[model samples]
Target chain A: MIEIVSAERCVACDKCVLACPTNVFDRGPGGVPVVARQEDCQTCYMCEAYCPVDALFVAPHTHPLPAGSPLREEPEVAGAGLLGSYRERIGWGRGRVPGARLAVGPDLDRAGPAPAAGRAPAGPARGARD
Target chain B: MRLDADVLVLGGGPAGAWAALGAAEAGASVVLADKGYLGTSGAAAGGGNNLWYLPPDPGLRAAAIAGRQRLGGLLTDVDWMARVQEETFRQVNRLASWGYPFPRDASGQERRSSLQGPEYMRRMRRRVHRGGVRILDHHPALELLADEAGVVTGAAGLRRQEGFARWEVRAGAVVLATGGCAFLSRAFGLNVDTGDGHLMAAELGAELSGMEFSAVYGASPEFGNHTKGLMMQYATYYDERGRPLGTAGPAGRDLLARRLAAGERVFARLDRAPAALREAMRRSQPNYFLPMEKAGIDVFTQPYPLRLVLEGTVRGTGGLRLSGEDCATTVPGLYAAGDVATRELVTGAASGGGSLNGAWAISSGTWAGAGAARFAGTRGPLPPPGALRPAGRAGMRPGGPGVGRAEVDAFVAAVQERVLPLRHNYFRTAEGLTESLRLLDPLWEQARDRLGAAPGDGRTALRAREAAALAAHARWMYRSALARAESRGVHRREDRPAAGPGLAHRLLVSGLDRVAVRRDPVAPRLLTGAGVP
Candidate 1:
């Protein structure tokens, strides 16, 4: 579930609100979005990925973390640059190289010759990695 | 608000976007309504997918189809398999031409087979918007509208972002690309995929095929929701005592499920994966690793508890039955695409997983769109509002008094209890299936006569309908499963352990309160072509 939205780093663009599939966030005072319906968060990390300024911190728990949890502290989260880490990891934002180049799977084009009728292919299954 | 379009597409995943694009390209005005943000909704938006992108080599194509045919229990049509391959090839290249930024190989050859979900959906949304398709995000279709002659004409839904206001669209044809049901198993971005399309189409007398195959599951960390199977492909299983469980690969899931069902804890470590491939896996599916990283567990080195999350019809190969190559349902003016339509034509009794399903979404969406456009072109003008009747019955216009929150919650919980458990759904027996039906059949009646939300309570209303759909879906699945009487593909019947001869036919299910299942004989050759059976 989502833990925090950093006020200092936030640009108040409301992208998280628009990007959230489950409507977990609502527009807050000063244009920033608040985690209004935290229970509805599916922990899919779209809000964290869509945040442009690295303002959102979504804990990876499917259920909500306790309020007293240390991850809720802004300094603990922001100081470690944990906010919007998903975006960075996915190489989605500015100046990051596309991560698709690193993808590995069966080479369909060069999987040797086709197998005999009713027989399994000779090479590794093409879509096994998917 | 009221809108008019030549074609109205529901659900804004890969299928719906492609449908809208196909319709627009066919010179038809299109409107797409998504329950969530277009680029952030449905299972396809949440993870990576591999396409069944075979080149036009007959040898390679035949080999591919034959391989899957064996895996899919000999029910796949060779003609459909070849057609999907051709369409996926063309569409992937088209995406490249539109600057989709496909990854290049070591020799600088673009790899058009796989897609990174986030980037893929973002580009698809932009492409569809540029194609002159009106997009209404956060609009969930409540029901289909039918003319006096029982032909589908339009649909009504709620605009969740606009103060829960009601919205309707009159269209010459309606395409349901609403994906499939995950039953709110928290499987990544499938929260919006509540089997609404299945319920809506079924209400309109549309039949469902392969629903008994809706028992698909994926391994995930107990605390995380990502159910992509790629990483789990390398993991080794263990019991709570840290002893090796001796289970590996796809077949190992049955053992893991049995142990878990027996009240034993399960754990896994990705030690079996090649060290060189770890980085590539992380980079390819970054989200899959995020939860483990945050929990301070190095999935590569540390053993963590895992659970098999039910993906239901989302990854499963059952849904609204198709009647033609154009992806139209039995109901005229009502078409199904993506996971919403049964993938049995290409995948047969097996789950399409990522590759075949991704390809099916592209091919079916395109064909359904063009077909709907042609359908609309011949229908003259949109029917008047008075001539159209709302076909939603169970949840929207209940016969009894309105149901409360508790009832809706109970219905959903009851459904999950029957469908989510491994013992109940995975290792099925005749006794267990009959018991499940004994419970679910009554819930169907309650859904029809007793479930309703108060006026303007959009959230509760949506929940009521989802509960109805889940209940209805559960019945269709169990009914078909009981009728099969033999283990084939994902529908494992413990009593009847072997695939019975003369049982290779597909099961077609229809009806609402009294769900019915019948065997539909598979034609020797669905379409004339090379490699006909």
Candidate 2:
């Protein structure tokens, strides 16, 4: 299951909504994003990882397996290099694979809008933390 | 500052959503305001409490009715209760039919049950939206407005992330669906709950029905304040020999079922156990507690675990007073539901998903809201200039996020010095709670004062959220602990050890005009009825 987004905690900043690989959230008229399609959750913790406020929780899925930093797998975009090929092989939209585990991440941008300003470097920052 | 909606639901959990949807479907222009985001209210959060009393067979229907009848005053109208039950089933069924995966039971029946905690939250949130409940997140209701005759007019609150963004929403009917005061005692340090809905309703002079029956729940043992792991991990309390303690029965399901049927409230106490069972518990790996890495390995292995726990965490059962069907207090137009309302037949074992019970709240909230709206219509909407400041608005001094090195250092020292290792569990005494209050209050205040500017732009807002929750928590604990001369259910009193007579069914009400406590007058054994004592 996709983690819970403390929507109350959400600043309506649209960071995760824009960063999503799928257009899962539809920004409502009131400026908050609506869970446009919750069923599409691939159980990826990307949204949680990227949530600066730590307002999300992905369930039943284990936390990133304990490992030494840097080498530790980033939850959603685990294998970016692999994901790129997977998306291309399936001929899915930008960064999306036809059926290969459609969780909340993938460096592949997919069908969503451009990533937010501070979000583009998520991979490197994640790597740096590792 | 002025806003318009056909129906304004004060809370955004299961009850609020159902009420909003029903109102909207009934052709009301609906606006739902939640202090938290969608799916995070009393219903969604805290392991949703949607429970149905199903019989092992059709023959047990009579048994169920008999059980209800035996309880008498303890039992809500079975027909009305059944109506709430049917509506809940319909809503859950509607959610499942929409493709949300609600796990089925052994009989392949839609479990139609809320295991409780965050898992239930996720499911209910998904289900509410899938069911088309529109929500306005982060809008916490601050005040319930009333006119000259004490009729409730409307409500107002602030936008958390947005500084000073105030909203005054006018509704045809206003439903107070805000969840109860658990976050109050745990966080705020107040003895009595922060009294959000109660305070607002009191401002309108609404007569709260049951102010004494406090909704009590055990704090998460080991993991201070987390309620999830207890629900999902099904952490069974066992002796050193691995024999289940308390209402011991094999398996979590069997034990819980037996306890509830017998009207026995469940509580978890820490104690030492044999190495074998300790190892088994260790292997089971409860999630809510601090990881062994943090609290220490023996944390789980030890007996009489000295930790704040989460068990029978009542969100105020005998807390507020209210009449039947009408979630109304003594004051007209002011209504309560979820945790803030009355804890009657709907409380304890009769509930399921927190939000799933939105139907219950909706029935009451709708009546209250419509009544309030009708009242408002007579007085006319409070003019834009007349928008009232939210009642109970504590103007907290702003500060930065992340405790400072000095504060952290002080906290560690204080914990080492004053934090007793004794079972500082819920069985509170006047001196103990007072001692805790004296020790913890200064630290909390000092931290709030000394902390530099809130770190992030929204840090001030976040701190306010934390402070409000903390204040409410402190108020609830101190007041409830002080009020209850005896211990019962979740509220264990160290001063008065055993359950006293004549106070069991008698409800407790805080001066705030909400039902604060409800006790069975006499133990069940003493009663002619069939309820468990």
Candidate 3:
């Protein structure tokens, strides 16, 4: 899933090794990073962004519902407004219930009061479009 | 750095998090540690869709427990099963309170969107924060520290700071939520799963069962690497000639078996699935959909390639044995929960995802947390550092010798490639397992020497520690596989496909020096069926 274009460019700073949440990359004998476990890539792209050499190429990546943004793109929290979605989901805005729904599933679905009818139909992210 | 807690819970997955929550709620000074940054690690890193809580329907509960008993061979602890089955709703409610998003129908009944995504952990981490429990992110427990009498008083681990700082935790009680072995699985993009807790507990003479049973699953052969699992029920399978190939369950074992026997490249007819089912699946498991879209494989009009995913440790059996009492290990003051703990509650059932295990993580974790907190209440001060030491200093890495990153990687790859997955799993045999060991034992002899770390590389060094843990675990797993000559559920041996009536038992493993398997009989409980009226 991840490929280092040319090993010659790799300075072996080990940033890619450290950046991976899945421990996807292990330092090769020559100090260049290798994708020994590509199947576990998840296409998160953390290794690509973290590689200081800019030698990494992750194959045709898909945007991960933008959970919060760039786990593989930028150095930022991916699930940005995820907490707000949480509050809306359980009928609790800020630790307090907005409506009389008991903060459980059956109760919140019927909802005395709430945010909106739909969220990320695919996931809880605020939007599906960029 | 050194720190102390009344109860220290290892790992930050659902189990450890819930364990910490339960312990903190019980008024213990709890400290939670993880190898990865908490919340964003473990199998639940994405978020969990299936929250297999017990339904209020009485007959369903009886039938569910009975089904598991039939599959798992009556080893299910009904008392523990009853408590966790009922109490897991509290875990679900706690998640809801923290704003975990579970899709509900117009009728407002909760829907199974997907098995864990980032959302589940997002709420869990928030709860951990609110619980006021002390946190140590990026701390992986390497070894358990014991007093003169062999009682566990604390653990020694790496803090994973600059050059990987040495760290120590003095605890009144320790819970091993370190999870199971995933790196050993096929399709190896090696993550943090190297069976640390399994090896660690084994070193201290903990008993492990179900090692013969691996948590193998199926995925789209075309997109298996990039995706988790395609919503199989919504897909149709046809051979290259368009002949019907049998479908797979949540675990995919059935599908794999049929395909293997038929000797055909089966393609899932996702195009035939109704729009509503496809849409529902997409919303439930978005990650599965994103990859399909990216790969240009539309389930609506096209058939997708299917393959067997050998995730040995995912729902794989073989973990620290749980006492019906309090999830404690044979070692006093030490307990295990989550994947690190064997599936005692659902022992006789299929190890499917969703509510079965997701809820198990929360339920077992909750009980262990409270049980540990109570146990901690009676603990005395930790023994002096000098008094607490491993029995063997040089041989303390447990099963083998020293090695470096490359060696460890190669070893893991070998296990994934030759020793495990298709060859050693599902289709099992005494000869196959024995042959696997014949290849693995030499590696074990060389494993420690192979698992080494340079002075400067902390990340590799941490992996080195985990590699040693995995090497030790591999020995135990393979040994048990060879010893258990019968097939049941995931532990299907071709030479012995049918489980012998007498062989419906457990094979306990420890003593890495000799690597012995002690078979224990399945003692069926008569009076304590959870919902069987």
Candidate 4:
């Protein structure tokens, strides 16, 4: 769920509008942002992360229930932009790019922060690029 | 407001971009309009895909070209597919020159991956931005404007900037590239694919064909599009008892169905791929591994749960029927390419994603763009605005009162509930289609009466139109399914399990009030190879 905690703090940079892939936000009459497509939010935090004033709070769905679980129980898929294909479509653990699956214990929560994404993470084949 | 152009392109995806570029470069004043910003919108913005490239080896290129010719028993336009096949070599080269930075081997050869996505689009958008074509962002054409003589003059679209207002474009020719129908389907960037081009063209009395093949269903555990083994012969499947079901292919579908019959949950797991394959996945999809990381389940190590659902018609077939030598539709002054036109190139049971579609977007867009410009030169100036007519007096908030959010949501939900369920999906039967049509009719009725939006709020208006288009799209797919009494390719029928012995006929549908349906054989089969006449 995404919440603009303090709308007053918003400078109306409209960064969220540009950052959004699904276009969940619409500019209202006074340039106030409205969650016109709230149901479509994939919770990628692009909006929150891009918000300079820290006015937005985004709590992404946890990994307690696996994806592809029945609908209405929870969102079966994520929004289809930026991180959506990774978190929703390309099911990988530990890293965004392909590699030997990261070692995780039986308990799901202990799975640490994702291996650094975007810049091909250091796979077992180290120093292969430079 | 009035905008004049020699050619007007009504979408801004790869196809639309190339179309605009083609027309503008050919000295036609072209204006490309997109509902969102150009270059960064449509399926392309989803990111990291091939705009059609091949491995450096001559043998691999020949094999890929030979293999694609074999879809749906030579369903694609051979000339068109072959043309795109050769054109992509240059298209990839052009994308690379624009700083796409495609991953290469140690020998500096561009490594090729079968999976396609938005990376190519990202670079293509830069190229489009550099192309200097006239572009209008946040402007979606609401209706195709036609002259009294029935030739399309231009289009009327809505722009949602400060508030909602109408934008009109006067053009000698228009290219419709609004993509295909993927009603509520998640894969293949179906969210924005509301079949706008189909509805607008159909409103202008254009015909749609091969809609029965619109329901192509496949299984992908995490992400569907570009997932190598999801539908292809690559992934390993696990049944409810955790028994490995072997590699996925046409036979894997049988395994999937059998597991479903046994009430076994199914999953697709990727084997630990080597660095080359891993680099290939990253270069093509880039984000394919994120979902697994989020869930703490490694795809290479752990099994990912997959579901079988109908692919959006963007990957199947159904759109404005292309005719004659050019990519022009039956409606004159109108042309279509990419996902919005008849997919004669993606025939048979092959999945229509990645390089095939990427190539089509670039090549067909160029084809339609050049064709439209040539036609524009052949014709006189666009007719006066007063002489042009709206697609209809009713569909556009044309009624007594427009609908609100509630009615529009209800209409969308109605289709989601009625037509999109698996029961009414891939395995279409006479009874199931009849029921689907029955449920879809009331929603159509509701669309006629209540589908409306506030003027300034273009989002709601877009949703309302999509709701109507989704209904029409579903109706066409189901009606076509009912008309085709045999099973073939993606149009699976429980009662009729095999491709019936007859000429492969494309189902053509026209009109909105009383839809006209007909079957026309695919003349000039492209490949003319094994198992087909």
Candidate 5:
């Protein structure tokens, strides 16, 4: 579930509101989007990924975190660079290499000569960059 | 609000986007109504997808088709496979021409066979807009409208962003690219994929094919919601005693499922994966590793508990049956595409997994869109509102007064119990299936007769419809499973341990209150040139 939307870092761009598939966020005072329907968050991280200023923090838990947990304010959490990490990983914003450049196609030879009933070849090998 | 269009495409995933583009290019006025934001909605928007992008090399294409023929239970159509390959090849290159930023190989040649989900959908949404298609984000179509002759003419839905205001679109034709049902299993980005299209189309007398194969499952962390199973190919499984489970390769899914069914805690480590590829995996699928990284677990080395998340018809090969190569359904002016249409034409009884489905979405979406455009062109003009009748039954036009919130919640929970468990869905038996039906049948009755929402409460109405759709979907799946008494592809019936020669036909399922199933034989020509007996 989403944990926080930092007011200081937020640009009030409304990108997260438009990008969220479930409409979990509602634009609030001062143009900032509040997590109005936190329960509807599917934890897909689209809000975090689309945030331009890295203002959002989405915990990986499928359910809501405990109230007033210190983990929300821990420097280690931010120090570990978990905030807006999905955007960085996908090479989305500034100074990032596009992740689309890393994708590889399937090797046709792996289909093999003989038919393997009930066992189709696995999809393209993930992370096979080399 | 009332709108008119030459074509009204429902659900704004890859299929719906492509459909809108195809219709616009054909000079049809198009309107795309999505249940959520276009670029980020549906299953394809949340993960990387591989396309079946075989070049026009006859030998390679022939080899690709033959390899998966037997695996698909010999129900695949060779011509359809070739057509999809050809169409996918054309479309991806077109995307590249439109500046899709495809990755280059070591030799600097562009690789057009794979796609990053976020980038792909973002580009598709932009292209659809540029093509003059009107997009209505956060608009969920609740029902289809048919004319006096029973021809589907338009649809009615609620604008969820506008205080549940009613919106209706009268179109010359309609295309349903609404994806498939995951039974609310929380598979990544599939929460909105509740078989809405299937239920709406079925209400208008459309049949579903290969629903028996709806038991597909993907491995995920027990505490997380990501269902990307590609990384698990290299992982090794262990039992609660820290002993190796000895399950190897994709064929070992049955063994792993059996152990899981026996009440054993299953754990896995990606120790077998090449260390060099870890960074690339993170780059390729960033969301897949987020849960583990946040929980401070090294998935590459440390053991983590795992469970199978049911993907239902989303990954499984079953949905609205197509009656033509143009992707039209049995109902006039109604067409199906993407996961909403059965993949038996290309994938047969097996799941498309990613590649085949990705390609099918592009190919079928284009075909269905153009087909719908051509269909609308033949009709002179949109029918008058008086001539059209709303076809939605269970939720839209309930037989009795609306049920309460508690009843709707109970219906969803009851459905999850019968459908989500691996023991019930994966390791199937006649007794287990019959027992599931006994419980699910009455729920269908309640959904059809009493399950409804009070006026102006769109959220509750959507939930009610979703509950009805899930129940309707489960009944179709179990009834089809019972009819196909064989262990073929993903429809594994433990009691019938072997595939029956006579059961080689695709099972067609239809009906509302009382579900029914029948065998539709594959044409003899479709079975040839694929090494089938």
Candidate 6:
């Protein structure tokens, strides 16, 4: 099963989810993709392949390898962007650059303080970049 | 009441069925409990999962090419994701062939492949029952049974049959495939979804991250666009022409850069008639761009022109933070899966394989269930909470005639009219958000008046569930909207018109009534935004 998108990297775009066919995801609060129907996954890398930002991963089970093909040790399932492959060769970087998972967090100053009840907290910006 | 079983699966959807059968097949007694009739609720309950986003070999080739070019360096391994695709294809095919009557394609192949939750939920019920899993209907897990130190021991709940009856069941481990908080949102007065799993996890002290992010998307037109999760295949946008339109763009690395860099609203622009797009627009009435003809003047011909809606904080990301194969929370003996567990595997709609993919993750529940069983071996029995508490007094309030049903309809209409298509579109601003909030608040206040306790037997339970779901979903929508100050992904803030260079960071908050905020580490690195590296 795929780990939930990190608080920082997930923009809640639902791209990783929309590309799926199984209704594996549902809109959690704040529009984030929630894995509502997970058991239906067939280990097909469709989600990992279609995720613009590699936000998803699909791995085979512990079952033996299929015939002559070697069992994949660590499947790095890739995602396809919304634009078909044709535009890819043309290198259109304008609006076609799909997202990928990132290892980062929110820059505090830009986002302001987290809310308390209905008001913003007065603590130091904790997620700010050093 | 005492119930014994080799396996006790909470949800009756695909995952639950698989968990029960997997264990049952392995020679254990299995009991599956569901809030609704088996397979009648959830995505598969309506029908089978939608089409595979990636069509076999050809689709894979196309996606691979697009991934490299459109996504730049962001795409992950194609082979692995393809494997996932292959698995889902086989599973769905097997289920349909095994008597789950999906709509057939021209070649007689079942083609009901869609992410439509209702459709998919229906199909799962038919097939799973055939697989020999014991199912209990209309039973909701009221609470987890725990030991003196709070270690999870089992579950207690109400079986809504003739009356509100309490029951207890013992299990080694429990998997919470209860879906997400869409229902909860309605309960809390949010425009979007409820935080069901989030609330449940929190009550058990499971650490949650990503509440600040919600992934709102253009609902598939077929599904009336009421539910999200279908924006991955096509990139909807306007051309130089000022009309609504769309294109089958690759998933990554293309026309999105300019907007991402400039912090413009990124959404789909459909090419159909306005009337055809009305239903989708009504439900999510998203923000959109007018496709421009060559020189950016003439409107394109397509009328069902739709665009991605990013008005509020509809990022669907949150859950119990996990460290490894073990999905342990700060609290022991508790386990979660589906949307509630926040595991490390994810993909787009086609990429994610929708409902079919969920079946694949049942192993997590199996593992958790087994682990729970193992823990139970050493732990003493837990004391039942006696009686399930009444729907708390804090949540009880009378419906005031001040906000009538008509007002809610009008409010929904007004929001659809004023907020959507304009401010809620790809290009969002603080001012737009503020304006939208103002417009929505009155209706929300009125909706509150419509909320109250129902009088009756099990009917009240059903009503209460619906009410709670609505309240929870509403709360997230409202609070998330207020929290986000800039445009990102599905959220576009007009006042903060430019994408922050610091796109790598995120916002984290806590507290039920008063949320506390903080930022956790950036999630696993696979896709970097336009600039923020």
Residue B15's lDDT in candidate 5: 95
Q: Can you tell me which runs of candidate 2 are displaced by over 4 Å?
A: A1-130, B40-50, B53-83, B93-100, B104-109, B114-134, B184-195, B202-307, B310-319, B348-393, B396-425, B430-473, B476-481, B512-533
Q: Where does candidate 1 stray beyond 4 Å?
A: A105-129, B522-533
Error of 5 at B256 (Å): 2.4
Candidate 6 lDDT over B1-533, as tens digits, reads: 56755346676555565555555555555567766455443433322233333447864534533342222122122333344356556655655565543433346554434332333444455555665666777676555555556555556555654255766666554555555443321111112122334444444555554433333333222101222222222234553454433343323212443344344534443322244433432221111111021112222234232233321222243445544443445556665554454422332111222332353344444444444444445544444445322222111233542223333334444534433343353344555545655655554344344533344433343333334333333334444545656544333455764445554344444444333445446433343234323
- Structure candidate 1, residue pairs in collision: none
Of the candidates numbered 4 and 5, which has the greater TM-score value?
5
For residues A1-130, could you state the per-residue lDDT of candidate 4 as single tens digits? Answer: 3433345666777766755545668866566677776665544443553455555543333112243443112132223222323322322224443211211111111122232223212111011100
User: Candidate 1 residues B415-436, lDDT tens each?
Assistant: 8999999999988999999999
In the order shown, the candidates' Cα RMSDs to the true structure are 3.2, 13.7, 8.9, 8.5, 3.0, 18.4
Give residue B354's lDDT in candidate 2 (0 to 100).
33
State the lDDT at B356 in candidate 5: 85
Residue-level error in angstroms, candidate 3, position B19: 0.8
* CA shift of A35, model 1, Å: 1.8
Reference-based lDDT, each prediction: 0.83, 0.42, 0.60, 0.62, 0.83, 0.40
Error of 5 at B515 (Å): 1.3
**Candidate 1 CAPRI category:** acceptable
Order the numbered candidates by TM-score, best leading: 1, 5, 4, 3, 2, 6
lDDT of 2 by residue, B1-533 (tens): 66776457787555565556555555556677776555434423322233443433434533444443333223334455554455455655665575543444346555444332233345555645654545667666666655445445567776653554767776545666665543332311111123455545544544433332332333233323333322222234543455664421123323443343344444443342333444333322223222222223344334322132222123344334565454555665555655556544443222222322334554544444444434334444444436443343331332434443344434434532322222343336778766765665564455345433234433343334334333333444455555656655434467886555654443433332121433434222221234433
Better of 3 and 5 by TM-score: 5
Chain B TM-score of candidate number 2: 0.64
For model 6, residues A20-107, the per-residue Cα lDDT tens digits are: 4333566678976777755433222334433444344332231223433322222211122212221122121356421110100111
C-alpha lDDT (0 to 100) for residue B461 of candidate 1: 88
Candidates 2 and 6: which is better by lDDT?
2
Candidate 5 or 4, higher DockQ: 5
lDDT of 4: 0.62
Candidate 1 Cα deviation (angstroms), residue B148: 1.1
Question: lDDT tens digits, residues B1-533, model 5?
Answer: 99999999998999999999989999999999999989999888888787888999987888878756656777788889989989999999999999887888668899888888888899999999999999999899999999888888999999887899989999999999999999888778888899999999999999999898888887778777887666665677888888877543555566677777787778988776666667766666576776688878898889888777788888888999999999999889999999999988888877787888899999999999999999999987667876789998886567777877677878899999999998899888999999999999999888888888877767788889999999999999999999999987788898998999767778899998879898875551353554433
CAPRI-style docking class of model 3 based on DockQ: incorrect
